[model samples]
Every structure is written in C-alpha cells, then in structure tokens.
Target: VFVCKKFLKKDGRKVRKAAKNEIMILKLVSHPNILQLIDTFETRKEYFIVQELATGGDVFDWILDQGNYTERDASNVIRQVLEAVAYLHSLNIVHRNLKLENLMYYTENNHNKVVLRDFYLSRFENGPITEPCGTPEYLAPEVVARHRYGRPVDCWAVGVIMYILLSGNPPFYDETEEENTDLHNRIIFCRIVAGDFEFDSPYWDDISPAAKELVCRLMEVDQMLRITAQDALYHEWIAGNGASEKNLKDGVCAQFEKNFAKAKWRVCIHSCSVNVRLNEVGNNSSRGILEEKPDEDQGLNVLLARNTTQQRYGPLKLFPSSVPAHCHSACPRRDPSTLPHFLSLDYTQMFKVACSTPFLLLICTSL
Candidate 1:
C-alpha cells in the first residue's frame, strides 16, 4: 500500500517550501531505514506526494508500557536510526529534525525495522548552514545559539533521542516556579543552549555507565566535539555488551506516561497512513480509527499528511462541559480542522482510556 500526502497550495510559502524540500530529499536517498518517495503530482491548488506506507506506529507507540522492554531493546532502536543518519551524512544531507515522533516502525511486529521519516527541514549542507527550525525539545545547541551549524546538529539530537529512549524523560526540561508552554519552552531553550542536563540520581542509578557515556558524547555542547552518527554506530552500547539486560519497563513507563501524557496530536504521528495498520489489527473499537477511508483526501490519514509538526500542535485537552465525555473516538461531526478546539475533556476518563483501561491510542493529530 502507498500513502498519498497532500499539501494545499494555500497553506502558504512555508508549506510549499517544505513540500518541495521533502520531495527532493526523499528522491536523493535509497536506504532501508528511510521513507521512499514513489510518485508526485500537482494541481493548481495543491501538491500530492505518493510514498511507501509504513504501517507501524511512531517510536513511542512501541515503548509505552510495552511488555519486556529493556536497555538492549532501546540500543537496537538507536542503532537503526544511526545507520540512517550515517547514510544521510555521507551525502552531506542534514536532517534538521530528528526525534521519537519522527521515527516509525516499518510494521507493528516486535522485530519490525525502525524507519526514519519526515525530512521537510532537511537540507544539503555545503557548509555551516544557519537556520533555527526544529522541535523545541530536540533543538541542538548551535541552532538555539543561532550559530552556523552542520551535520553535528543531527548527532546532538540523536543523543537527546537516546536519552529519552533509555530514561523515558527528556534530558533538558523546565522546573522553574512558573509554568506554561511558552515559559516552559523558553526555560528549556536556556537549558539546551547551555547544555545543562543530567542523568538524575534515581533514573541513572540502574542504567549502565557505558550507556551514560554514549549519551554525553552524543549530546556534547560543543558541536565540534559531538559524536558523529557513523562513529556512534560503533559505540559499546550499540555494537557490544555495554547495554544492560535489566528490564527498564517499570521506571521508564512511569516517566513516559507522566511526561508525554499532555501532548495529543503534537507528537508528529500525523500521518493517517498509520490508521491502516490499526484496522488490520481488528482495532475497530471506540479507541481505534473508527472508520477507514483510504482514498486521498477522504479520511484522517490524508487530512494530516501535511507538515503537522509540534509547533502547529498542542496538548490534548479532551472534552469540555459542552461535549460529552462518552463520545466515540470518530464522531461524525468531528472534522480534522475543528478537533483542536475540542481538546478539552474529562481528564480521568481520558487516562483510563489511555492507561490500564484500554490504552486509549488516539492516533488523531491536529494543526
């Protein structure tokens, strides 16, 4: 099956430029771990990009309270991403954005290969290209400092990914007296630019020292000293016995559920293409996609095929007094465009649907 991504020309120059960039980058690489572009067509009002469909969910989908998870499992995931980055670097192509949200499994199976997706912010690096564009949490030091940067920026992001994968918490976060998205982002930026992060006592205690060393090397503040993806692929944790066999499910799940519980359509799993996989698993319940309209522009899959990054996304607020908490996952009146305003909901019911109740996996994303 294939996923056809649509971009309304009216979305403006930023969207058009991103579409152009994504097409160019997909055409330039042929790797097992990267998304491949198949065909492209454009109309006066829009552009359509038909690419191979990855039926598996994003990185977090496989790790959240997933059974039998371990440090070694996280290592395997990182190694695949490093291999993809290593290939991109060899061509001098820098993927400005690299995070858990952008990484997907080729299928929902336990042994599915990890595939790196999303390349709209990618560019061919002739030198230290300077441009501040990326998810706030995953931004590299040079990007935040507004310094000219190159491929090492991607490596720093890899470190952040590794850190999140191993500990279930972001390396840099806001803990000040005041709190809000804007302020939280600002404080996090300060921490990122200063390379202020820690393995915190309890989180790092059971984690292997070699794993910690690799995280530090990948996330080094000095871009010049950051470990390259090609080099990182050979790290002890990734290539040898550095990763411990100890199961990290308990601690990792606790933090992941708490930290990311607020983000709704914000996690970049925007492609409706993932819905096809859900249907295959007989997930026809209220928490599933509810219906399937695979034709382009027909269902949730095609509507969110555009650049639905975190910047355009906000936390899932759930139902308000106006809307009932018992509503189905795919309410008929619920259009993708109007879903964001409907985010306010019953917090208790939402968690029950998400955690022990049924893992309320709302793959729904909004702009």
Candidate 2:
C-alpha cells in the first residue's frame, strides 16, 4: 500500500508554501536510499501526495534489535547517508533536517539499506540560506550563529548523527537544560556558535581516532573548513579501515535510550496533543504520532520504513516537524558532572505508545 499525505491549505501561508516545496523536492530526486514518490492530488482545501511505503521501520528500531553493533556498522550507515547527500549536493539541494529520526531501513532482513526521509524543510540552495531552522542539537555552527549557510549544514548534521550512533549521547547537550530552559537554550546556542563540544573520556575511549577526526572536521566551527558530503565519502572513517569492530551495543544503546527517550523541552512545554507512533511493532507496519484523530477510513498517511519488526520504532520523531533551533542547554564549559543529573521522564503529558496502526499518521502543527 502507498502512503498518502494530506496538507491542509488553511495551515497558513508558510505551511502551504513548505508543502508545495516538499512536493517539488520529492518529485525532483530518486535514490535507493531516499523515499520515492508515487503520485499527487490537490483538492480545493488540501493537497494529497502518495508515495511508496516502508514496512521495515527506522534505524533506531533496527539498532535495538541488533545483537551486535560496531563502529564499522555506524560507519556504513553514515556512508550511505553521505552518498545520498552527495547526490543531493550535485543537484544543489540541501536537506536541512538530518537527524537519527529521519533514517529508516528498507526491509526486515538481517541486512538492509538505510533510507532518508522528511524533506519538507529541505531546500534547493541557489544562494546562501540565512534562515535558522532544524533540530537544535543538529544545527550547524553557522546556523546557530545566524550566519549565512548552505549544504555543509547537512554534513554537520551527519556528524551529529554519527556522534549519536557511536556514543548514544548528543555532543552538544547540557544535562541542566531541563530546569532553566530559556537560559540553557541561550547557553546551548553560545556553545554551538563557539564549536564547543567534546568526545568525553569513557565514551570516546573505544572509538577510533580517525572517526573522531572526521566528526571534528564535519562539525568544524567554521563552515568554510567543514567537509563536504562528497569529500566526507572519502574520509578514512567512512572509506578506509578506521572504524573499530568492538561491539558497542550495550553502552551505545543504553545511551540511545537514555538520550532520546527523555521528554523533549518543547514537548513538555507545549500544551498540545502529540500523535505518538511506535515504529515496526510486530507487523510490516510503521508507527508514529499525528495531530489528527484515528479514523479507520483515513487509511495510511505516512510511511516510516520498509523493515517489519516486532520490536517497535526507534526514537519516535522520524516524521518530526521542522523545529527551529531555539532550544536551551547548559554551557559546555561547566564540568559535565557539575550539572544537575537529569532524570528520564516516562512518557507522560507529551508521549503515548501506539497499539496497531498500519501506517504512521505524522502531522504536527508548530506552535
């Protein structure tokens, strides 16, 4: 079955514009690692776009099911993403949002290719883009600083993705951001603008040096020095034998669950209904949240992955909205230990688990 998305015209001028732009981008590109568009329809009040569906689920769920995961595996995943980004770069397009939530698997097999999704925020870079939009932790230094930027931002996001894939922790998070959010957001921005992040001891101990070097280059404070997606494809960590074979499943997964499972700052603060979706849970179906009510007649609206799994989805934001990076976090200069230890919030006001949805209905309205 194909997935159909309904974009309401009344959502406002910006949303309407974004929906049209997304449709154009989806129609312009086709790669084995990117979602494919099938058809489109426009009504007087809404636009309906249909696309191929993924039954496998997303990268997060795939990671949870793996008994053995290594730096090499992470490298392979990153390489595919870079290849896709390189292809897009050749076309002068930029996927502004490139977080873990956007990567999915193609099937339920033991081995599958990862695919990239959610291009509503992606844009064709005709010139320097000045808008600061995207997930906070993944925003490039130039974007955080409100400076002109373009495609390197995606490479920077790839660096953030690689960091989480290897360590299970966000490179730029401040444990204390939960208490004083606005102040912390200011602090996080300052740190990001300064290119202040670290490969802390225990986490980086087993990680390969070449991999670390690549992360640094991708997240270079100066966008001018940042590695392009095409160049990054040749990095030793991605091309050579720089990734370690040591199984990092326990440590990395524990951190992944710890970091992503927390109720996000906006989720906790916003007084809105969150459509929570669980990926690949016991069926060839995808799981996700949407603002719309569950209606059997509605059919499928969004497809997360092609992998079928009994394990459920990865961090539940694969079809997340374009969140402008105004999040809070602690200053990076403070000793990580000194920040108040953050407690994981069980899915309460913001999150709900899905039971059985053949396809994810992920429609979020930004507040």
Candidate 3:
C-alpha cells in the first residue's frame, strides 16, 4: 500500500505503533474476503506494507466502471462484507473504518470476491471502543457523537456501503451543496442521529424490498437494535434473493449514474490513495497519472472501452480518474512530493479536526 514517508517524518513512535496494530490485527484474521497481509518492511525513512492485490478496483470506482450493477451484484458484495465482519466480531476485533474504499475485488476476473483491507483503525474489543474516528459520511451516529461503541459501528458502515452499492449514492448525505460544509455536516449528522433517510425513486424503484429492509435494519439508529453482521448474513435478501441476476431498468440506471456523477467529487476526496496496487498484478512498466480532465465527463465504461489497459483489469490499469493531480505514480515511486503528508494527530483529536474542517484537511491527517 502507499504509506506516506511523512509518517516516519512526523513521529517514529506513533508510526511504529500504527504499523504494529495493523500487522497484529491482520495476522489474527485469515479469510478469503479479508485482505491478507503477506509481509511488511520498513526502511530508515518509510514503511511498506505488502498485501493482496485487489485488481478490480474499489467498489465506488467499480460501480462507475461497470455503469450500473444489479441487486445480485450488490448482494454478493454485501454477503462477503458481512461474512468478513462477522468473522472479525467472532474474534473480538472491530474494524472501525469500513467503507467502499476499503473494500475491493481480487481481480477483474474475480468480481464476486470482495476483499476488505485497511486495518489502521481496527482493534481488538472487549467492550466499548471510545475512539472517535472513521470517514465522515460513513461514521455511525454513535461515533460522531463521540460515544462508546464497538462492532456495531462496522455494521453501520456496511449498511451505508450496501445502500451505495445498490443505488450509487449514500442514504444519508447532504441535501444540497448550497450550504457551507459545516452546515451540510450538521444536517447529515442530524439525519443519521434520527435515522432519517429514504430509498427514493427511481434508484430504489428497481431495488427489491427485501434489500431495502436489510438496509433499514442495519442502519438502525439504536445500536442495541441494529442487526449484527452474523445475523445480517442470514437475511433473506442476502441468502436467497441474491441467487440470480436481474437487470436494472434503464431509467434507474440513468438516475444512479446521474447521482453518482454529482457525488464523484466527494468520492475522490475520500479516496486517500489512488496509485496503490499489488506489484503482483498488472505490468509495472508504464506509469501515468489518472487526473480528472475537463471535457472528459463520458460514461466510465465508455472511457474504459476507449482506453482499455487490458482485458483483465479493464480501463483503470494505472489508477482511477478520481485520483487527484498529486498522488502516487503510475508505478510505485518513493518521491516525497507525490506522497500525502502524515500528521501525527491522536485518534480522538483527528476526528474532531475532521468534522469541523474541510475534507481535504482530513486526508492530510490520514493515519
């Protein structure tokens, strides 16, 4: 993965602690749906984590690349996610930061296999975890409120991920971009706290009620009543209805694409690392940046079709177009200028700064 050299540059101790936590947590887990930690090494100046190569890209970009996915596609993905989370809970480990970006496919050839990665925020839980952390949009209300929480937080994020997977947009999000972000955040927080959101048409019109019901249970505001990952795996929607592929209607696809395009900017911001990939996968020779260019707002698949990196990995051979102008090289490089500057903010302090400040500020402080 693309660890910023700024991590060691800031504080060697905290960096080492983070590395230990990641490695320890990863070592405890062994499942196909979870990303495997093969090895880890540290130079005097930086750290490098060797893990599974999710060549199919993350779920968000994968949706864009595939245009629109069916319920079966989303169900299969959610099943793997739930299974992984259940396994983690069985081991008393809580993945505090579970989002679309953290879930990826092993390869384009293996679309059904979704692997969960990023263990920096994960920890072994005995009771409540009081850490106030995680991505803003996916943060459970309890987390945002800075209350003691545990495994349920991951379940909440899974619900949000499932909603986006099926509909191409988050259930709880800003109503409009007119207001300043702080105001928008307040609105989002209030809705999440109140459990106020809807599966509005035409995105939800084509989606099965069983799927929506599961989402409702998972995203329940009351943590005590929310569905656990193990129970979620047995939901009818996940176990039975996901048996066949049902094509999404044309109008629903149009609506989802439109909504996703509007929210694409936020997705880009939350995607902390763009050029991170397993060296085991594609050709490591050609290096190119995947910046968003003006006058290129074509359908993702249309863009992929024209730019075919290869048949196996689709168009995003190097990186997704969502990658900002300043991130990893097409091929892995040790250039300090392209790396994110890591701030040694403690978890609680980081979360506070994240909620009140710009999203870019949050990225700047990413552990």
In model 3, the worst 10-residue window by lDDT is 302-311
Clash number by candidate, in order? 10, 20, 0
Model 2, stretches more than 4 Å misplaced? 179-181, 262-367
- By TM-score, the candidates rank as 2, 1, 3
Candidate 3 Cα misplacement greater than 4 A, ranges: 1-9, 12-14, 43-45, 242-245, 249-256, 259-367
Error of 2 at 257 (Å): 1.8
Model 3: per-residue Cα lDDT over 55-94, one tens digit each = 5666655665565457887788899999999999999999
Choose the strongest candidate by lDDT: 1
Q: Write the number of the candidate with greater TM-score, choosing between 1 and 3.
A: 1
Stronger candidate by TM-score (2 vs 3): 2
Where does candidate 3 clash, by residue pair? none
From the highest lDDT down, the ranking of the candidates is 1, 2, 3
lDDT of 1 by residue, 1-367 (tens): 3444555566556556766877788888999999787666666766555566565666775777468788899999999999999999999999887887678788756555998876766889987775555666787877656568899989998999999888889898767734344455556666787789998978878999999999999999998889999999999999999999998888887787666552323322232121111122112323341234253322111112122222222111111212111111111112336645224434333333233221013323121
TM value for model 3 = 0.67
On a 0 to 1 TM-score scale, where does candidate 2 land against the true structure?
Answer: 0.72
Index of the highest-TM-score prediction: 2
